[model samples]
Target: MNRSKPKAPAPDEPLPVEIVDAHTHLDACGAKDAADVTAMLDRAAAVGVGRVVTVANDLTAARWAAEAATWDERVFAAVAVHPTRTAVFSEQDRAVVAELAGRDRVVAVGETGLDFYWDYSPPAAQEEAFRWHIDLAKRVGKPLMIHDRDAHEDIWRVLEAEGPPETVVFHCFSGDLEFARRCVDRGYVLSLAGTVTFRNARALREAAVHIPTYQLLVETDAPFLTPHPFRGRPGEPYCAAYTLRDLAQLRGADVAELGAAVAANAQRVFRLPAVTARELRGREG
Candidate 1:
């Protein structure tokens, strides 16, 4: 399939505080090599998107994400066979994902979970893979990043049945306030993406307002779900600034304060190492 290329708009005003892009696909965003990744990160950093977690949906992409994390101190990785690809998931695929999940820079064990919208994979296959990934996340002692789409109940059921990992994050959370409350009550983190910026996403925006600051995170899910005003265009980690700003407005909170809280939540959830001032400056230099 020919995918639309990302649209690069002029960078937004710099955020008063730095934040992390909890989930993105650097490879799918057309970042081919170290130089390309660096260039993207450079643009992100200029707007205070200081760190990013590039995720993978398959074995080859998983390998690339792991290597990309090592390329920059600011980049981390999450690896798994996406739910849609679970139909073809095999023992070898499982082994590779398990291996990658244990890597130093592979901070999360997902982009996994249920996706019932597409018929590409059977529900059984998706469930089985979701269970396996849940186990993998527990075994590797990393947070489980979920990709729930039109399968919220099944997603919750499987997670409850499998006994989710200590840290469970609903990537690009698509539920309303009630679902958000359920997740929050269960101690799950909700990572909001650009979709929250859409005018028609009233429910999503409302959910965002109710989520406690400590349980909130921000992501771009780049190359897709670009924020409004730039919707239908490409998105990147830097574009997270737009989402963060919008979210802060919805919550009636200060942008810098919210950014700091979200950054802390990401660090705690992903167990990211604290970057020294010297190292941070070196990257900026």
Candidate 2:
């Protein structure tokens, strides 16, 4: 049976707003070409997701994401091969990531980190790749976007061994409260995604409270992990709004404050420019 296509956004004049999505993947989102990206951005902007860090797990996707970032002011790119894609890394891979790090439109060095959930790569290979990506982040003076999954101990060990990153953001954080405290102590940023809205995400919710407000971030990880209300559906960057709203309620802060905090956290972590639609369009020009 054919699945229904994702509903495209209605054409509406873009509005001015201040928002940011800490994580996204443009190449894998099924939006091909400039017009597709324009529509996706329109949909995100309509819901106040004004800025997004489009992450790519390989050189091809990284290049595409960087080009996409150039297409719109709000879109910034994160370049790194994911844990599962460790085999793709080579000496030239490091050089390319270093080069991408220098681009103005490129933000962080990630969606990198440990993911033992599916050990497609040998554990040693994953560790090596994670270290390499972390080194890239250090070399470029950018934050490291981590993707830890069921390998918390190993992740901590590697980070400690490699020396702590200046800016460490746990994208799609899934650690327990103790781990949250450890991350907080290290001044690492904990980014919550759609999964936090799940009824069974007790550990995530508990960890959320323990993290300092300024240290918290929200993401979509979209094209995956759609939150509770939309769970079982394909996720998208625009759905980050729902996650943000749920987080604010959990934290007992106003949604406006939540937005401001997460947006600030994103800017701090990604070093993204203060992107308004007008500013973004100017960049596109």
C-alpha lDDT values of all predictions: 0.92, 0.81
Question: What TM-scores do the predictions have?
Answer: 0.96, 0.91
Q: How close is candidate 2 to the true structure, as a TM-score?
A: 0.91
> What lDDT does candidate 2 reach at residue 136?
84
Question: Candidate 1, which segments miss by more than 4 Å at Cα?
Answer: 1-6, 276-279, 283-285
Model 2 agreement with the true structure over 1-285: per-residue lDDT tens digits: 998865532322322335687898866777777888878887887777888889988788887887888886668889888898885578988787778877888888888887888858778888899998888888888889999999999999999999966999999999989999999899999988889989899988888877898898888888888887777677667888888878878878788877877788788778766556546666668
What is the alpha-carbon lDDT of model 2 when measured against the actual structure?
A: 0.81
lDDT of 2 at 1: 100
**What C-alpha lDDT, on a 0 to 100 scale, does residue 257 get in candidate 2?**
73
Segments in model 2 whose C-alpha atoms lie over 4 Å from true places: 1-17, 278-285
User: What lDDT is reached at residue 115 by model 1?
Assistant: 92
